[model samples]
Target: MAESTTQRTAGSAPKVQLSCEMCRQRKVKCDKLSPCTNCQRLGAVCIPVERARLPRGRFRKSKAAHRVPESDSADATDELKGRMERLEGLICTLMQDNGAAANTIVPAMADAGILPSPCNTESRSDLPWPVGNDVRDGGGLVAQKPSAYLGNSFWEGLMHVQNRPLRNLTDQRHDGATFAPYDILVHGLTGRALLSPLCSTTEPWATPQLQQHLCHVFLSQVDPVFKILHQPSLRAFLIEGKPYLHYDAHRPAPEALRCAVYYTAACSITEDQWPPAIGASRASIIARYQRETEAALVRAEFVTSDDLTVLQAFVLSLIGARSQDRSRRAWTMLSMAVRVAQALSLHVPDPPFLITAFEQEMRRRLWGAIGLLDVQASLDRASEPMILRSWLELHAPLNVSDDDIPFGHEIVPAESDSFTDSTFTLMISKAQCAVRSLTEPGSQYMHIRQACVADFQQTASQLLRNCQPDAVPFHWYTLQVADYIAASMQLIALRPLQRTPDFTPPHVSGSNLLRLSVDILQKTETLHSDPRGHPWRWFEGIFVPWHALAVAIAELCGCEDAALIERYWDTVEGAFERFGGLVADEKEGMLWKPMERLMGRARAKRDTLRVVFTPESASAQSQSPFLPVMTPDQNQHQRGMGLAITPCSSTSGSIGVEPWANVPTVWDEVDFGDVGIDQLSWTNYQDFMEDMQR
Candidate 1:
């Protein structure tokens, strides 16, 4: 019987042993030992198991959940592609048509069966949210429709300007057409001849070579102060004709942006510095590019366009305009730029959409530039700043080089401690906070001045020391701008003291107010007269230091020190010599008359001080303290003569001497500690007031 049982057991399947619960759960092999190999390897406790397992067979069927069909998704994608292709085709067709007005034809075709219709309620289900209402129309990309078009008197107003016939665009000509000036047009209808005498087939106004030169000029001279455009990316685009394809990419900067760069470059340089190969006068080039820039902004519908690049272009145009002169037209344009920036939500530090690191840094830089410009424009108009008081969360851009920001998805590098292209702009950004305090109701000047000094003085020194040799001129310009900012803030702060009934003038020996005023005037003269700073002198018109000049003349009228008066007078005369003709024709040109009268009063003060301090005043004047002045060698190799004295001037006394030689060049530690004004002692206070009234 035992032999028969053994034979049956052998014939049947061998006995199966169960694995431990740990190994069973892990689906790993296990020996029948107490601590299995899998559990020992994992350092887990092996629980002995004797649970029954389900019988192996075909698995039970489970109910399926609802999902979108692949076919439907494919169809939608295909439909979207078809719509895009059709849109491109329509654009090409319109471009080919000679007489077709894009404004009139786009809506007509959209109404007909030719183009894809606007996404309405029924079609909204197929389109994505937020982008469903966004479509290209005649007046550029239409703004998103408000959830409710609320209006006064319970009347529903139009939410979008799309397909609407507006009478005038901001930069449009008197005529209703958005057309480029004849000077900016290069090719002919037949493509065989040029339309304008200045236009050339190889290198016209907007040719790549001219653009390259101007762009280099801008990058070297003006961009360091602003630092908005990415240097490497822009240079690459100029060379390879492909911009960085990423969020908010300009794609070879649109016409408005391109022309803005050109206009600004022309404004920065003098006529002599203009490329001789281009064969165009600087004035003519500036006028043509300026008109074309305005026309391009009109065509882009800058007021309503949502493209960040369009806003950038408009801001740049306004910057150039304000640089040339702070006219009411420029202020009006600045208001438009403010509105556009607000519409783009640039005030918000963090946006709802995903953006690359490079784009984030760029947006911050742009906002910084916009805010700074707005404050400056306000200062020029004597109005409150538009953005400094706002609840903006945007921060200053990092002081990093353009190359530090990666184009790919790699992590962004840390901001550098050394000076970079963005250092000056970052300084401006931080200093603007102090500028905001100047306009507040009960703000303290000392606190603000100290804040600026503590924030910028050391950094400015470090940056100047760290700057590249080739970029010294731009850094010097930045240093001068810093000095001007501090002096101007003090000027703004002290103006009210002049009006107060309890005003007190500083001691006759020396006044920080006078010193600061002289500092401002000296910087202004340097910005306009220095050959190194010629490429950035466009700012001279906007920041003319009229207030500082007035204050310096007033303080000099009460001065007792002959040398101090002479030195201060030298600064005033230098300013007049450099900027007299430019500001003479400006709207504030009437200021020159009172300023000249004040100059006369200051000369009288100088005569009195000379009588008191030293005899033989007339002979001593020739042998002045700052004398033994060296006139520039007439035969020396000279660079472009940009607002500098003519080399062949017959009046040979200190003819070619730098105006700022006696003035303090380093702007590191300016003492704005005791800035005040003297109402009773200021001889031409009434004259200053009269000129202001005029």
Candidate 2:
């Protein structure tokens, strides 16, 4: 028994040591096990160190006078000076190189007509707010105030003037106050003018039952995409009528956010799903909720407010507004929200001592949402993205559900690898980063364009892998949307290639670009037509793929392959028939007239081709899953009209199946420049389209 006990004691010895010797030298926390994390990261062999016995005495304070020798301090100072000198020299060398490069590039750009000449003499208007090096008076103002206006989407004065010594609007103001007469009216005296006269309470549209339903819808459908609000906290606040850390009477951020949620939910509700007890049509409900949201925004003083909740409300309201109207007004409002986010420093993470991990994650999510919205707005109008890549240091939020984050706790749960509440938001952030280069002027270069495509594909594949095949409806829908976004961004990145003269075999490039466009259009068509996509149709309706439709129609006008031509026409006309309402619309002004012309050309091409498909082949083609389904009457009408209805024998993927190098050149008869495609090069397609309309 004594021998057995001795053997058991020897076998029960602890496996862990004090720490690896390297970690001990570096003074980093480490797991005491062999091959510690720090050693592994540094690729060093971990040497285990046993714990040393310490003397049972207090730590002694070192004498300040004897801490260092005078000669050693002098040596340290000399080394520091040498390092500073080297840094200064390197900075000067870089500046000189950059200046020389700019000097060489600018004149070349001017010669190439890429930059405006000095003698162009175009009047450039400055902002109403003062911006200069000397706005201070003789009295010498103590400090400069920050301007609320950050600038247009293309650039911001704040970013420009941050490093420079400059006086802002504060120097001109009487008491260094940033508020103007308009701000006084909007923020102080005229609150009643904008107050909701429809309902006496804060949310008249939100009865308890209705609020529950809307909250459910928003949480399930919209929250997955936005991921701005914390579900548990939001629900608690709603139930208890309590305010968060930044909430106040003057800044009604929570109320505004609530109204915004109600508006978004109402907008997202399908006609069949509308509550009968509301005693109003879904349209009327959306309008009333929208008005309430606007009133709430005014009450919250959103323009001057730097509250996170206010920004969330503003973003949500803009999203709801997009469903109602695809106008520049929403884009302008979105830019204002971007400015507010910048003011709040949402582009950077907060220190651990300053905020809880939960709040930090929330802020990251809000910034991600803003970037996603900016990307959407840019795509909608073909304008420069509001949130530039240079300004963002924010990372995507963790892929965990709200339940994983405990309220008022320091613990941060591990992020899930599979689909979660934040998966869609993370995907959007990735997509935004992928396409950000598209807004840069340098993206016209072949290397940058190719890099953009490569980066986007890599990110997209990673995202798709994270999503499960048989996940929930929204997750599956997000997958399809990912495919759509991938196609759209690739099209944008490759669009500049068509204008380049050095690209060999223009026909192949044109064909590849056309296939990308077709893929985008088909994706759009599928999202709108599918029954599962009905919940997300509000968003789908807003982002109509106008550029893709144009490309497809342009290709079809010259395409000789009967089957491919018909497939192209089927995609184009399906888009047109569904979104034809926009053709007559003056609000969300797209280039419908140019589209009409392209369709005409396609019809003319159809008239020239003989319709010679046998009934048996037609039946087989009709049974093909790739082809668009049409009713008997519709087919008869199209046949009578001599439309190009040929059977497709080729069985390949619907989305750009042919290899890039092997795509036959069919762009011989296409004249994109004549149809205002050239004008789309430097400006928003809609802006050019509007000019053409005028």
Candidate 3:
């Protein structure tokens, strides 16, 4: 029965052994599955007892059936449930701790490119870290813990904890909160490509966004061409789109053009790499010339004589430089002297004698530089016959006739040949020479005086014979000739009075001279008094002739007849006062003051005469050299030879007035012999002669 029972027991028992749950948890082997299938069905771990030495003759029962009693089963089950619950809670706490540690390690790992995008499981838990076991113990679960961070978790943890403060520090460092979003986007994109794993995905070919960004960067780098062209207008148009197309066209504004030219010239001097030797040499030469010229002007201020040869030489040098290649740089420097001369002529502060000489010098330099023949070309281009006539009237006294004078070259026959026009060319050239000579000192005055007389006679004869009495245009020309005649007569009168006071009078009578003087005075009064007269119509044209007449009449007042002299004086005073008022009306500020001074001088002279002499004060007049008509022997010769009975000389005292005293006058008082009329005329004649010789 025992044997049968053993067989049943062995047949009923399970064949395979099972491990205890503790040894199996640790992966060790076990003898049997104590409480294995049954415990498993009950949701309990199977545990086996250790093998023990058996007592002699005693049978051992499996301790597995000695499980808790039925009454204590509930208690044991409760206790097992509590222990399992506690163990599970401990494992969860450990898992939470491990996940937090991983979170700290992952960022640096990703930065180093050692961790994958989504980290593997082994990478998460391999702390102290086995290769591919990246899980750290302190922080939260992190998928991609960088290999770099895993090397030092303590440092990584501090860095992770310090993120907000570091961010604050970065914001303070860059002051980046003030930056615009576009700026931030640009910086962030750039940094990500430099620092992140995404760099590997970046394409070599330019994308649309990349192209746009590159273009913006390139445009920011270069200066705008239009901005360079219109520098002054840059600020006004910078923000305007399509500035080049929409802005005003660059027509150089006058101020901008002037400034540009000046600046360009200045920059050329400054920036050009001129040879040091040449630049220094040129600068020194310029400085010396300036110093010398200034010194010359200073010397000229105190000089009493009218010789302008030094100044002329300086001016000629300047003009000669103009046609030369090297002299371009001297143009501005030369203009300075020319301007000074122009100013001096316009404002004549020098004595009349000196002023006359300076004006002649100015004309000489101006005409000489522009070739002599060019003056004729200028006159030939005149559009109006009246203009030609007026020009001749003002200038012809200094000119001579073509037949009497030598012209350097004759006009070719192929061109239009008018005798009058050819005569006009000769006239202009002669006039220019005459003006030049007049300005130079130590020039002979006799020939100029004679040429002036001859010119006056020729002009007067032509007008009186050819001009119709009613021809208004021709009248002014006749009047100008008459003025020249009067001026010539006055000069002739002054010559004998100055050098040879005791000389016998000429055959010409003072009465005839008086008649000529009265005629001119009456004509001038009639022409000026009538506003419709040609002289009044073209006032500027008549100013020079009128002034000459005034001077001539003033000299004429020194005649023999008291009544006529008084009449001449009154006439001049009235004419000058009227002219002075007209000058004021014209607002010709430059001429008005000089005209005023002349009028004032005339007034003072007239007032002095009124207070000194009565209406019948002729007898009180002194016996002067002008009183003797002819010496006794000269009178007898005229009577005996059946010669024409010469009229009483101005020296004769025939009208019961002593010869008019030849008072030292303005004309003779100033010794312009160094710069006189005759000398000027001879110089001009010589120049003409030289040109003929050439």
Candidate 4:
């Protein structure tokens, strides 16, 4: 029986199943979670399945669910039809408005039209309307639709005038030989050109009559060329396709517009010719000239696309002529010149000339009003301080020659020297004073202040080391260094005082100590490797002695930022390790002998100890009060013991000791006021001390 049942099951066809719409479309197994996989993927609400009830009769199948009502089905079909009809109408309206043909509209609607045909095409054309179309023809397309043009006819007409010649004007009538007053008047009225002659160069020219005649020709003929070129419609047609329209067509090309402005200005000057007649002719010419000039000025001001150099030069000449006038007009002209110069500096290709011109004009105006001091003040306000600082830093090396040694009287003479030197010094002093003044406390400019501080610090340190003591006093150099230090301190203090606790500090940290240490470390490394002997190192003994002094001071002062101090220490320690051997032997008790004696010392019979010291004898004359002395034996012993016990004590406190206890002090007993002990005595003393200590 089991074999027979197996055979029957095997013979039966496999059962096929249909999935829920959600599950089948989603291609996921329908675990039938509250929403099936398909329903979840589709974001559709799933309906739960109900169990089917069995019929009472043997093996009777359950009936299927009932269908929708006939009337409801018919109504649904009718509603769908109505919506489709509305959509078709919308598409037709959009197509018509976009200037699509009726046939095109049908195809679009049949395919996938998104919008109805447009109701009006007047506002949609990218090209100008045909020239002959009537405005009143509502059904017919207008030939010259306003929508087709990007700009008004003014720009287009101007461009045409520039490109085309005047119909009846003769060469002689507007030539360079004789004045054509009538021609000049006509052209000026017609906006062809100004009434002045245009000269290409500043060299001497012909007589006034000839100049006037040339001016008339240029005004009557050449000036119109530029006007036509500036026309919006024409320029637009040239740049964009004939089918494309630009709203700013009248706007001039950057180069061409600039040239046109300059030329127009060139035509306005009344060089050798008499002024325009004072009746209607003059008034009309003046009004037209003013309008064109104003337009050109506006163009120069806002249109960054063009080079304004030539135009600026022309404007500058006009301002120069009227600068002495008492009227506001003169002031206006000067102001315009200033603005043009500034703009040209930024946008024009050749900035040097513009910068020179601006500097000259500004000096002229300022000197006339308030002298050099006020002019300097104005310059301070006008330019970025860093630019000036950078200029000085870059040019300083070039200014100093081999002949200009800091200490020598030849380079830096006494007050009684030649007037030229005095004048030079005075100028430099004045410039420095001006820069410093702008950087003083409460000044609105913080960048200038920072730059000034950095510059002063560098200069003061250099002068202190390289210059002779008699050349510039120690107090003066110290004062400058003190100023920088004070400024640095202020910068740090201001951060905490001026801002809320939540505010972050600016990029320039308040840790002057950290910056100073870093600077010293970098400078030391540079000096050690420098072939020429780092020039700044000449004053190491006079200025801050230890490269690590700044860091040490910072630490002593209880500066909150420890990381900066640690970084500085690391850099200094690294440098010490690298170059320490060159100066002294850390393992031995011997001091560094001069380089000349290195071979002799190496060949010496005894094992010698080396110590690194700055050598007080080399700082200045032996009698100099600033010279440093070797530590006395008793003091050295006490300091070594104290350091071993309390490493931190040396940084904070003093250890009292006598002069002759554990180590020999080389110069302790020598009376060197008149003539210090000989080098042999000092060396013998050191050697004896080392042997005794051992």
Q: Which is the leading candidate under lDDT? A: 2
CA RMSD of each candidate after superposition: 23.5, 25.4, 44.9, 31.2
Off by over 4 Å in 1: 1-204, 244-253, 389-394, 408-412, 444-454, 458-472, 483-512, 560-564, 581-694
TM-score of each: 0.59, 0.60, 0.26, 0.18
Give the TM-score comparing model 1 with the true structure, all chains together.
0.59
Query: Residue pairs in steric clash, candidate 1?
Result: none
Q: What's the lDDT for residue 146 in model 3?
A: 31
Q: Looking at candidate 1, what is the lDDT of residue 203?
A: 31
The candidate 2 region of ten consecutive residues with least summed lDDT is 134-143
Compose the digit string of candidate 2's lDDT tens values, residues 1-694: 6445333432253443676678766768979767887888899999987632321222212223224534456766765554444333322222232444434435565566544444441221111222223221110111222223322311333334334333332233324345554334532322222322313222335456667777788876677666888887776655555555445533467777887888898888878878788756788767767766776676677888867788888889887877776456677667788888878878766533476777777778888878877877776655668787755535667778888885655666798866677777777777777777765765655456657756765655655455542435575567667767766665565453123333211123223444556657666766766666677776677666776676666666656655555545666677766655532243246456556665776788766663753355445555343333345644532221212112121212222222121111223223433443433222332333344345
* TM-score between model 2 and native: 0.60
Give me the overall lDDT of model 3.
0.32
Give the Å shift of residue 25 in candidate 1. 84
Cα lDDT tens digits, model 3, 1-694, are 6445333443354454445656555454544656655455657666664422322221224323333334356655665554444333322222333455445645465456544323343343322111122321110112333333234443453344334221233244335345343223322322211111111112221122322322232122111100012222222222231232132332112212222222121112211222343323333323322322322232233122123332332333232222121212333334344444334342233324433332332343332333232221221211111112222233222222223222222331232222221222233334434333322232234545445544544534443332322334323333333443334344343232112213222222233333333334444444443433422222221222232333334344333344445545555555555554333123243334444444454456556666655656644443231232234544533221111111121222121221112211122223333433333222322332232223
Ranking by lDDT: 2, 1, 3, 4
How many backbone collisions does model 2 have? 0
Candidates 1 and 2 compared by lDDT, better number: 2
How far off is residue 3 in model 3, in Å? 99
Model 4: per-residue lDDT, tens digit, 1-694? 6445333421252433344545544455677566666677777877544222322342222211332434456765765554444444333323442343444535554444443334433343322111122221110112233232223332343343345432322243234355444334323333343312111122122123323433343333322211112223222332332321222323333322333333333344332232443222322433433433433333334223233333432343232222112222432234433454345443222346533332232222221221122222222122122223222222121112212223112233222222121122223333443343443344433444444444544443333232222233222222222333333333322221121223222232133323433434444443333323222222221112121322223232333323332334455446434433322222131322322132133223112211222244234323212111224543443321111111111111111122111111112222323232233322332333233223
